[model samples]
Target: MTILTASAPRDEMSGAPDVRVVAVPAGHPYVQRVTDAAGIALLPDPPVPGAAEGVWWPPVALDPDWIRANGDRADVLHVHFGTESFAAGHLTACVEAAHAAGWVVVFTVHDLTHPQLVDQRPYAAQLDELVPCADALITLTTGAAAEVRERWGREAVVLPHPAILREGASPTVVALSEDLRVGMHLKDLRPGTDGPESARTLVAAVERLREQGRHAVAEIRMHRSVRDEIARDEVRAAVAGHPYAVLVEQGRLPDAALNAALGGLDVCVLPYRYGSHSGWLELCWDLGVPVAAPDVGHFSDQHDDASTASFHPGDVDTLTEALHALLSRHEAARPGSIARAEIIEARRAHRREQDAATATAHAALYRRLRSERAS
Candidate 1:
C-alpha cells in the first residue's frame, strides 16, 4: 500500500516523485498491471496474516481505522475493486477517515454491478457511498462513465485499460485453425454467467456454422471445484455430448499459462451474462485472438470494430451471425495471409500507445490532485 515520494512542499528535501496510491485489493492482475505501468514502481505490501506469498489480500485500506492509523503512507486511495468486501456504511466511514487523514480518495467505478453477487442492491449501495464521497472518480469506458453520471450526477475520468501483455515488437500472427476454435471458459460459474444458456448458444452456433459448410468446434472449460455445482451440471448437460463440442475440466492456471491457453484458441467467448467491462477482452486483443462477449455490458465500447464481436448469450442466431463475421475478419489476418497483417499490426501499435497514454493520464491526475490537496 502507498505509492509515496514526498509532496511538493517536501520535494525540496527529496528530488523525485511517486504518488503513493493505496488502491483497494492491490493484488489483482489488473491492478498490478496498471500500477506496474510507466513511471510507477511496484511496491511490496507489508505482510498480513493468511496472505499468500507476494500477494496482498483482504486489503486494509478498506478499513476506516486502518486509514486513520496509516494514512500518512499514501497520497491517494484509488479504489477500483473490492466493493463487495465491505458494507456501504463502512466504506462511507473509510472515506471520511481518509479525508480526515488529508489523503485524497479517488474511486474507479470498476463494476456498476458486481459479477459474483446475485443481488445488485448491495453493489449499488456501496457505489452510492463511493461515487459521491471520493475526490475523483475513474472508469474504463465512456459507457460506464455515462452510467455513473446518469445515476450519481458525477463525472468520472475515462481511462482505457492498459494492455495486459507486454508491448511486443509485433503482434503474434493471428492464429487460426483449419476450422474455427471457439472457446468458452466458465471459471466457477460466477453469478454473471448464464452458464447453461452460454453452453446452449455455443452448441447452436457450431451447428449452424457446420450446416453452412463452415467447420467450427466449441470448447467449454470449467474448473474441477465447480464440477458438481448445479450450474456446472446444467452447463455440461446443455451440450449433451455434442460431437463438435468438448468440455474440459481442470485446475486454475498461472498467468503465463492462462495466456498460452487463450492464445491457443481462434476466438474466446466470454461467459458473463452481465458486468461492466472485461480484462479478458484486453488479454485476447493482446494475443491477436478475437473475442466474442455477451452484449449485456460495455464490452462493445472497450474495443474497436474488428477486435471484438458481441452477441446475446442465449439467442443462437445473434451468436451465429457474430461468429460468422469474426471468422471472416480473422481469415483475412490468419497466418500466411498478407491481406490484413499490417492492419492488425497497426492496431497493436495503437494498443501500445494506449498503454502509455493511460499511464500518463493516471500520473497527471495523481499529481494534480496531490498539488491541489497540498495547496
Candidate 2:
C-alpha cells in the first residue's frame, strides 16, 4: 500500500511501496536516509516564507487538484509534525482529502511544545482538530502521548525517535579521550529567557572544569539561524570569563562532518530549560558520547546508565558539579569501556524496535482504514 508522509525535509524518503514523502526543496540528511532505507518516493514541497533553511513548513494553500491527481497512487497519509505555516494547511487539507478519497490519515506528534508553552495555542488547537480526524496518532515519548491524551482525550501509540546508526560503515572517526574536548549542542538559543540562561549555566560549568586544572577544551556549536546580535552577546558574556570556552556558529554540515564533530567530543551537553524530547540527546547516545543534560523534562526519563549524567536546569552549581563528576570519571578511565558500549548498543536496539513498531502501526492503520471504507 502507498502512504503519503508529510513532515520536514529532514524525514523524507526515496522509495517505499506506494509511499511518497513531501519534503522542502532542500531536505535533511536523515530524511534522505530514511527514504533510501524504505525505498519510498519523494515529493518536493515549496518553501515557507521566512523559515530557516532545511526546515519544512506545510504550504498554505491546498491544491486539491494536485492531491486528487495523486490520490489514487496511495492508500494512506502520514504526517510527521504540525505547524501554522501554509505548508501545514496544505498538508492538513491533503490528509482530509485523502480521507475523503477513501484513504487513512496517520500523524506522529514529535514535540510536546503545545500545552507547555502558550505561544503554541493556535497550533495546539489545530492539532486537536487534526488528531480526531486521523486514523491513528503516534508520539515520540510516553510522557508526550499521556499529555496528548489528557489534552485531546485521545489515545496515541508511543514510538521513540530513531537513532543515528549506520550499519556496515567503518568508524571513520574515533572517540576523543577524556582530556581532548568538551562539546555542547543547541538547536536554538533564543526561545524563552531560559535559552540564554542555559548557555550561561553551560559556560559556568566549563569554567569550573577549567579551574580544576582539567586540560579540557569547550566547544559550543549552534545553528546559523541563531546569529542575532542579542543571542551572540549572551553567548559572549556567558563565556567572557573563561579562556577555554569557544563559541562556533555553523550552518548545516554534511553527515560525515557531523559525525566527526560528535566523535571528537568526550562529553556532549544539552542544557535545555524546557522540552520533553531531544533528538540531540539521541544522537549523543548513538555516538557513544557521554551526555550531561538538565533533569527537567524528558531528561528525567533517561536511564541512569554510566554514560549519561543529569542535572537541574539553570543551576550552575549543580551543572558544574555534574560536569566535574563526568570529568573525574573520565580521568579515572571509567567512561570509555564496555559500559559505554553496552549503553550505546541498548539504546540503539531500543530505537530500532521503536522504528519497526512505528512502521507496523502505520501499516495496520492503513489496513483498518481500508476495512472501514469497505464496510
Candidate 3:
C-alpha cells in the first residue's frame, strides 16, 4: 500500500488536512515529542519496506534510493540526528533524492559539533550539505539559530525543547537533608567527556566541601563500556583515592533507571569538555536537577543563569568554584527546594502550549513546502 495518497486522512477533530513526515530516526524521544507536539503524523519506521531486514536506523533511512522509492510514505522527510552514522556525501544524496522526488525536506539543527568527534570538520561538512537545502530549519535556542544565520546564512525557527519527562510523571523533586549529592555520569565515555580530568577535579572539590563540614559527596557513575575502552585501573584508582568519591559501574540504564538516577542527585555535573547544546541539560531541567556545565556552545544559554552553574572547561579551580557556589545556593535556599508538584504543574502547561506551537509551525511549514512543490 502507498504510504501517502491524495485521500490521506485528515484530523478528525479539526478537519485540517494532514501530512505524514518521516523523521530520520523516529524512535528518539526528542523526535517523538516534537512531532507529537507539532500535531504531525509520522510514518512508522521499519526497514524501508524491501531494504535489509536488520538495518533499522542508519543507511536505510538515510539512503537516497529509499527516499525516492518510499516517496509516497512521507509528504516530507525530516532529518535530525543520526547523520553521524553515515558519511556527509550520503546525506547529500538523501537530500538530493528528496528534492528530486518533489518531497519537502526539513532538517533540525541538533548539533553544531558532533558529540563523538574531537574535530568539528566532519559535522561542519554535513551542515554545509544540509542547511542550505532544507526546506525549513528548526533549532532549540536563539543562540543556536543566530549561529546558523551567521554561519550558514539560514534562518531557523527557534523552538523550545519540550520537557523530557512527560508531565505528571510523578514528581521530579525529592526531599533532601543537609547532605548534598553531586553526580557525574560518564556514559560510554564519549570523546566530548574528559572523564578522568573531570573526575579528579570533582573528587577534590567534594573532599574540600567535606573538610568545610559540608555533607557533600561525589558519585561518579560509568557505563560498563568504559571499563573496556579506558584504563580501568586508573579510573578506579582515581575514584578510590578520594574518600569523598565513589565509583559505580553499570551498563546503560533504561529510561526508568536513568530517571531515577538523575532524580536522586542534588546536582548533575555535565562533564563535557566540548560540544554543542545538550539534551542532558534539558532533561536535568525537566527533573528539577540543576546542572553544572562547562561554558561551551550554548550550554549556559540553555537555561537561566540561576538554573545552571557554568565554568571554564579543563579548569579544575573554576569547576570546583562553580560546584561550591551551587551547593552554597542549595543551602541558602533551604526549605525552598523545587517541589515535584510545582515542576509538574509548570510542565503540564508549558508542554501543552509548546506542543501546540511546534505543531502549528510544522503544519505551516509542510503546507508551504507542499504548495511550493505543486507550483
Top of the candidates by TM-score: 1
lDDT of 2: 0.61
Order of candidate numbers by TM-score, starting with the best: 1, 3, 2
Whose lDDT is greatest here? 1
Question: lDDT by residue for model 2 over 137-187, one digit each (tens)?
Answer: 777666777788988888887654655666532124454355647787664
Better of 2 and 3 by TM-score: 3
Ranking by lDDT: 1, 3, 2
Candidate 2 structure, TM-score to reference? 0.74
Report the C-alpha displacement of residue 296, candidate 2, in angstroms. 4.4
lDDT of 3 at 124: 88
Each prediction's whole-model lDDT (CA) = 0.76, 0.61, 0.75
Query: Model 1, 1-375: lDDT tens per residue?
Result: 112233233442363446677877676666665665444433445456786786555566678898888877877777877668776599889889988988888887878888888999988888888899899988888898889989989988888887776555343344445867888898878788778888888999999999998889998988888733999888879876799999987889777677667766767898888898888887777767788888887999887568788887788998998888888878766533464456546667887676656666666677778779889
Worst 10 residues of 3 by lDDT: 1-10
- TM-score of candidate 1 against the unseen true structure: 0.88
RMSD of each: 4.1, 6.4, 5.0
